[model samples]
Target: MPVLLDLRGAKSSDVAVGTSPISELQACLHSLAEPDHHLESRPWLTGIGESMSPGLGHRLTRFAPLWARRRCRLLLPLSPPLDVDMATELDRVSRLPENDFVAAAAYAVQGGSFDPRGAVTRPGEFVAACEARSFSRGELARSLIDDPGDFRRVLVRTLEDSVDAFFAKEWERIHGRLRDEVEQTRSRLRGLPLAEVLSSVSPAARPVRDGRAVRFDKLQNLTVPLGGNPVFLVPTIHGRPHLIIRGEPGFPVVLHYPVAWRGQPPSIDEVRQRLTILSDPARLSLCRHMVNEAITTSDLARRTGMTRPQVSRHLAKLRSAGLLTSERSGRYVYHRMDVHHLMGIGVELLRVIVR
Candidate 1:
């Protein structure tokens, strides 16, 4: 009879009549299947299905989750490794004062290696590493696993910390930029009611990467498009981005950078006038509360554990003065501020106060 065999990890020709036994062949097959079995065990696959679903690049899903998959596509604008144009933009920015400061700081940490900033982040691995490193510096807890209230507090502190770190120029200019962006996000979300914000956004498109599309149906309610791409928008717990998305749960993708859609910068005088309102302690507190999204009087009372009447009075004064805006959702009203406008004012006031 002709010898027949399949080569596993180990090299083997057709087994002769007296070669390896059937048991050995069985063990080799099992060994070969082990990694695949491990891959299947990941939590992300349980929800949306597995990574081998005939789309995108091979084996990417085995590591990252569905939301992450989408985020990877979304980051095409920021992550140099994923976008060629991003790489060029980074190159041009590298010579700028902001970038030079970033390079010097990054270089100092890398044992004085004079790697070009663009080169440092050109590859996907490097870009991921940079994000990981940035998050590590802030050291936020895994919010997805934490209590919602605690998560929100942690998020807010983290944003405040990010602002402080930026003042110190910790990490680099990119880190500073990311910090500023997150702070803006927190303020933006605070000004609007969570329900209204969530309802206004709908997932318009799925990120098709490497010829594969992520499953976003589960996140239909949470999804919103900032420009053209879909983002799984989650409220900042405390004041941080806490929502997690995945094709499946455990094997999740981390989305970096949440951006707000806005027009050009507001005039300086407009900002200054707002800051004048914020100079008062009561208004400052109100401004902080309105940083991310709007809250109804009842919700604000619950959040602050204040009496509804007192909350309503405070809200009334702010609304009457145009420091905040309110909209009715059913019988209850929700409130939020103009985050970009308030922030510009707050920033300028901070500068003036410090000076």
Candidate 2:
């Protein structure tokens, strides 16, 4: 099912573009939680994991329940100010009412609606309830239900410790880039329609009902009527491979979109090298197969009717050029093309040429 945003009667003022350090911190935690999908953050996460104390690391794990499968619903910023700092946002989160915090935690566990009226008194029953929803973090959920205040403390402490560990430096490094993206997006909004602006943020967004509404192909089914509330579009560098949306009632809808690549554009030589790598007929054929699915060398050999060594040689070249990514599943290693990078080659080349 798709998540629909009814934009009926929504004005330009109803949409806003901004950046939030707290949201980026949450994204960093999520990236650390699921490093496989977030390959871009693997090196940073590895470094933090090695340098941090084990006790602090364990405390970070307490947040795993809130980040079920790398998606979080707890402690999200609700229409945060454009210049909101991490301390201010964290303070806001720390001040949430106990019941609201518990309810948000429960929603995070199952990624669904929760009724506080149906709350269970015992920790065991709370865990059982979460388990029924396929949530495997029993102890964490139990802790949240048993003593919500202590859990809130631990959550806040873990976030604080994480900033001290690595997020502070990371945020400093990427803050300017995030702000640039927001400014550019807002500039676009000045000339483009809301639907076009939404689509530019994420390709999955589509305008519907003659631009009165927009829909996204999301994991959950939801219909949010703007009803005069604002929608915040937040861009994050660490939040790659995920587009998070929070549209709970009584709060402004927030969308955290990923911004790919950083620093500088590729040099002319690098662009030429990538173009040459893809110019080969056999490699282009291989890319056609790998673009949509990850396949093992043996599978590629069979499909292309080429020898194993030939397929390996081509795969190696693709991997070296950063056009391919591979993952090991048991005995077999599957390789897939980085479709986003591949698609951006034209823009990269144009940037270099124009420069």
Candidate 3:
């Protein structure tokens, strides 16, 4: 669902705000609000408040306007083995009051950077841009909006003309500027290993697979190269992945490319320990909701329909045993777990239970 802002008889504005990035950003966001008293009490607001970090929010805010402009369409492709019940479940969740915040945030993170109008008026130009970036512009833009085939050929041509080689060269030059800062920080700081320090300071980068090519700087890092429009490329590996800051074409900004890696598996005892607690149906259910995702205590309680005290007890135990990690997104505390590790334990425990 697109939230159209009414700008009748108004001229287009550039990315202009004089305040400090955060304050200016806050003001811009405030301008977008239409006064939702009901939103104040919803779990979604709390979720966004608690989930959004100042650092992350600032980073995202820089991209929010760009993302909002690009979110012309949102698509979910359905393949065979169609389950009507699955669709029903999705619809139910979509209508939930808590989903609004998440949806808004997801749009900012995923679709905010593209030109939604370009997908239509300049279909050929859009396709060319995507193609130059080694991606499928048609499918991607179509997935976000409505029709793909209708605008494929034209979109490709426009994108080609609009996207130029100079953009990539300019981006690489800017990246050198950012990388220099990282190097300077490295020289000034001491103690921790260089790799760890590098990962720590870079919000968009993480250590993965013992120093393989860093990921998360480019769109290609997350998706497979398919003609028309690219699709998300799910990796075989798991856990919190890393993104590399690499130079890209057509944009003079550092791009985030997400990448994955395979590492040594956890010890058998480690598996047993996590499963030992999660083996319980109630605990397992809680773990499932949290695995690979963060959720606030209140949301967890609401989702499970459990008392706060009950949820608190389970979370405490999980955190104590290192099955979960916690962070403060805003006024709320969120918990996330390693799904691969959790699942491995579950499988092992099931085998033992069956035997």
Which candidate comes out best when scored by lDDT? 2
Sorted by lDDT, highest first, which candidate order results? 2, 3, 1
Worst lDDT window (10 residues) for model 3?
14-23
Query: What tens-digit string does per-residue lDDT give for candidate 3 at 120-193?
Result: 45556544554454343334433333443333333223222212312223223333443443344435335444
Model 2 lDDT-worst window of ten: 114-123
* Clashing pairs for predicted structure model 2, backbone only: none
Cα misplacement distance, residue 26 of candidate 2 (Å): 1.0
Q: TM-score per candidate, in order?
A: 0.21, 0.72, 0.25
- Selected candidate, larger TM-score, 1 vs 3: 3
Give residue 271's error in model 1 in angstroms: 6.2
Residue 179, model 1, lDDT:
43
Give per-residue CA lDDT, model 1, range 1-355, as digits (tens).
1111111221111100111111111121222223233232234223323322343222222212211212212111221222122224333323334333333223212211225253234433333443454453112212212232453343234323323422123223234444455444445446643332332222321333321232232323442222222233322111111122322111112232122324322233444555555566655666677768777777777777678887777766666545677888899788888664444454443322321
| Model 1 poorest ten-residue lDDT run | 12-21
Each model's lDDT: 0.34, 0.76, 0.37
Write the residue-wise lDDT of candidate 2 on 231-334 in tens digits: 88889888764677777665678888877555444655777889999999999999999998999999999999899999999989988877999999999999
